[model samples]
Target: MVELRRSLSLVSTFLILFCTSTTAQPPAPRRSRTRAYIEVSCQITEYPDLCIRSLTAYIHGANATILSPRKLVHYALLASQHRAQHTRAFLLQVSKPLKAKKDQEYQAVKDCLEQIDMSVDQLSMSIKELRQLGREEATPSPSRDDVVWHISNMETWVGSALTDATTCLDEFPGGVRMSRMKATVKAKVLNVAQVTGNALSLFHHFVVRYRVPGSPKKP
Candidate 1:
């Protein structure tokens, strides 16, 4: 009887400790907040899937906590810049061989290269403006006008870049020899434009959300 009682007491003590330890731990924070950021922010854009895909990189890193509205604007700009750079690289590669031949395709490729170069520059400018916005945010009394102007500039530049991408695609000849190249180039340029367009939409939402006084900020 004594041995059985001792065993029962030990088991009761172990169960109590286990329950206490388990109860002491906090519940894991739901990722729904992070997902809400992607879902809500991407809704304004036509290319929600592309916007979500572009933002996936930032969502997983140590920097994940910085996925606020203002920072999302910065992330979107970076994604646009990255896509623009990739399209520019592709254009540069294809332009080289065609340039040597001086074929009719050379002019098309040359035009695209010029447009892509401009798009890259514009996206770069948008990124710089975002940096400026960050600086302004740290001020004691950041100028709302300054914030508005910078966000507007980002939208304008990104929008222009998207237009340039479309122009590059439209410039390609419908000839059989260039069909494969045209298809490839078109696909690449469209990807850049789609992401840029999505970024522009995100900027618009950021403007609306932050512009209002006493607006509830998202988590």
Candidate 2:
């Protein structure tokens, strides 16, 4: 009887140890939420004409500010292709009430379009000035520092254009137009930030890779 009781006690101890070990083990860490990429391709087809126009205007403005005038012009020329594709899709999917709301939204888009147009003009002037400066032997060539300053200014202008576009769309409520515009703005912002960050990362990597082993300079 004593041996049997001792055996039962041993079994209980083993069971308790097994249960405690199983319960005490920490759960696998929750997976991180993956960031979603904005698909500007097929989705843009579902928006209204006014929304497309607004998006085109903003894209033009961003390109003008972010790229050379030549590139901006190239992008502007491609705008018609996008217009053709999206127009058909929008007309098919867009409702009459949505169209009516789009007419109202047009005012906001028009204002943004005008501002973007003005920005494009300014960008054109800047490009001309930059070209002329480049041509002048007496003006002295722009230093690397000057190049960086110009790039920074361009980024600031692009950011401002994005802000203006967002403000224009903020007046509207739920709809394909508003949703598309919001998504476009967000995608552009994310893209710009990602590009800038990647460029900086590459620069750091290059600096580190080429650095002298004992150099005091930190990338």
Candidate 3:
């Protein structure tokens, strides 16, 4: 009887341990509560599909929790910055083959390159300002003036970046308008400009929805 009771006790202990282990849960991700974060956030953007595509990769995996309204704006800024960098890199490649041509088209391409270089710099500043906004969001009680200042700077810089990209395409010489290289460069620049404009829209959305008085704070 003693041996049987001991055996029963050990089995009960094992069952308890098994149940405890099986029922245990890891912490739920912010994504779980925000299943529609991507959908709702992208819906208001200028390019919904591009916004969705740009942010979907970051919304999964270890970075999944980065989905507050402010973080979404940051993500959009990052996407714009990446697109600017890509467009700049492609322009560099296109410039290489034309460097020694010394034709009107070559000079025009050089002019576009300079404009895109400035666009990249402008986007870089926008990205920096957005990052500063993130830091401000973390403060115990961020100042309204600081938020306005950072966001205002981001708006101006990102708008300038978009204008610069447009100017790059406009500056493409009429001689090269039919060239495949020019078409490719122009398309890429347009992509960067579109995404930057969308990101700026999102920044405005965030400010209106979260930064204003009586706006809802993150849960």
The candidate that achieves the highest TM-score relative to the unseen native structure: 1
Give a tens-digit lDDT track for model 2, residues 105-193. Answer: 44544554444344344334434433333333234453444444443444454344334434433544445555564354334333323
Go through the candidates in order and give the clash count of each.
Answer: 0, 0, 0
Work out the TM-score per prediction.
Answer: 0.75, 0.29, 0.73
Regions of model 2 farther than 4 Å from truth: 1-106, 122-142, 176-219
Top lDDT model: 1
lDDT over C-alpha atoms for residue 58 of model 3: 71
Clashing residue pairs in candidate 2, if any?
A: none
> What's the best-to-worst order under TM-score?
1, 3, 2
lDDT, candidate 3, 1-219, per-residue tens: 999999999999999999999889766755444446876888887888888778776756436545577777777777777887887787777777787665556776787778778877887887788778777867888776777788788888878887888888786545653777778877887788788778888777777755657523432
The whole-model C-alpha lDDT of candidate 3 against the native structure comes to: 0.76
lDDT of each: 0.79, 0.38, 0.76
Model 3, residue 99: displacement in angstroms?
A: 1.9
Question: Sort by lDDT, best first: what order?
Answer: 1, 3, 2
